[model samples]
Target: MATLSAGGQQDAACMHIRELTMNACKVAHSAAGAVAEGIATGVNALLETVRPREIELDRLDREIDSAVTTHITGATEESAREMLACMKLSIGMERIGDLLLGFSNRALVAASRCEMEDVRDLTLMASRLEKMLSEVREAFEMRNLDKALAVLRSDAEIDRLRNLVFVRHLENPGGTHRSESFHVVFMTQALERAGDHVKNMAEEVCHLVSGQSVRHLLRSIDKPLEQMFLDQLRTKHAL
Candidate 1:
């Protein structure tokens, strides 16, 4: 059997990284789904299922780390940038998985004590996160900057939901004892922070494909989004 050339090896390594990152995204998405259901339905058994998936995400993160370290030493600049993007994405997904697991644990303990409003907001956050992860997978797979931008835009809603929860729990006017307020707040934070990591992954996807940060693209371009993306692609190809 003939040994693969260096370029062939690098290509294989990058593909492996992409595959592992996609798998991690799926795992995180599944975790989010489980948390959403567990919170919405008050099912402890539903929440119990995320722990092993969290372990799978960690394993994928380590695998991505090793793949990048091994192949990035002698790679071309473009390939190296993509490999780094893969590493960033995998790390973000793993953190998101951990956050979802934490959220699930909190739900197990506090879902009973939470008010209807609290459960509604928490479920909404998890459901939104699940959708975001789905978009992250699609955006990364297709290198779709538009989808990535959409993910970035959706993060604000998560932030808003988190703030709503905080205001309700932190300042009750009647001097009432809010049972499991700490757990509710912690769960809110975990979902919000997971949204943040998802945003970072979307930014990395934009950067990986377009050679520009999401902030730069959104701030510097005055044209419509589709036009700006088209112009950028033209500029890249013309170089």
Candidate 2:
């Protein structure tokens, strides 16, 4: 009877130990899950903030374009310069907006916010640009060299289009009316600066990815454009 009582006590102890082990495992799993969920929530909130800002920047760009077109066609010098300054401000503001969107998009994706549309064409360039910007931001955050390089290459096309727009304005001056030249020039300047802002963002991506400062490099790259603009301004002043 004594031996049997001892065996029974041992069995009870073993069962209790197994129960405690199982409970501990469950608690650990729960804690890990909570941490993951918190991270996901934080990422989603960040992305939503980015998306609306990008959209607003796009809207502002359109507004700048319209203002430039209108002012060039009918406005005086003071009015045109004021409008041009506003357009430049819009370009600067939009670049900042793009950076914010890029950060948010990555965070959202990391958090599993939702899938975005994937289309490729000139018609979809704006969307593509937005996606590329987002990827650039992600690369910067993750220190991804490949993605940063990709963004630099992709921005080349944007530069090309911007130059095309500027050249077109200079070559054609579009409107039948003579008074609109000032406004057209202003629009061309805004478009060119928009390209510069995009280039600046790409340079930032490169810096963030490689841990190298590229501000000087960008300034070097832009020298020709800057010189051309300066020459044009000097010629205008001479006249």
Candidate 3:
């Protein structure tokens, strides 16, 4: 066997980190897809997809741990930055998965019984969330601040769609059930939370590219969409 030189070992480790980052991104995308599939098919299919994907994500997380352990020692400044950024990105992705799982059970029940328009609204929301996942992936891949900002901007639309769902549900009243309104709430909240997590990953991209936090960078100087969402939310809570 040929003995590897010290420099060659470092190169291999950096490559491993890159691979782990790619796998982490794939896991996030898969989680988004699970919601889409669940909406298109039913809860059972969504549940199946989520369970296996979680196993894959757990496997990748372990691999990242092992790689970080082996090669992170005495790394150069640039390589260290890459490792740390990728680690944060992996975490953001994992949390997105967890958030998606949080409301899946309730969403499954709601999906089966909600009105066609409500279902349509939710399907649109899920598509938007999935697109955010794609943009966040691109932003990280290219280290592009613009793409990340776009992801940030997209959050407003997610909030808008969520509001639409709430307004329609409120107008109709007990469309699902009294207690089961929570089901609709969970589904919408899942989209909003998913968008927030995607925004977190986008902020990570901003930091990696600019060495500054853009988390507070004029994302919402004004209430986006309209005052209607807050109005809807207040009215719903009041009743």
Q: For model 3, how does the per-residue alpha-carbon lDDT over 94-203 read when each residue is reduced to its tens digit? A: 66777667656667556677666666666777778888888888887888877887787777788888887776656655465433455777788877887888878788
CA RMSD for every model?
6.5, 24.6, 7.1
Question: Against the true structure, candidate 3 has what lDDT?
Answer: 0.73
Give one digit per residue, the lDDT tens place, for model 1 in 1-239.
99999999888888888898888988889989998998999989889988998999999999999999999998889889989998999899889888988988888877998989899999999999999999989999999988898787778779999998888889766777777889999999999999999999999998887888776777766565555546665787999
Model 2 residue 214 CA deviation in Å: 4.2
Ranking by lDDT: 1, 3, 2
lDDT of 2 by residue, 127-217 (tens): 3344444544455345565565555555555556545544544565565233333433342333334335544555555654444555454
Best by lDDT: 1
Q: Rank the candidates by TM-score, best first.
A: 1, 3, 2
User: Residue 166, candidate 3: how far off, in angstroms?
Assistant: 3.7
Q: Mark the regions of model 1 whose C-alpha exceeds 4 Å error after superposition.
A: 173-177, 223-239
TM-score of each: 0.90, 0.34, 0.78
Score candidate 2 by lDDT: 0.44
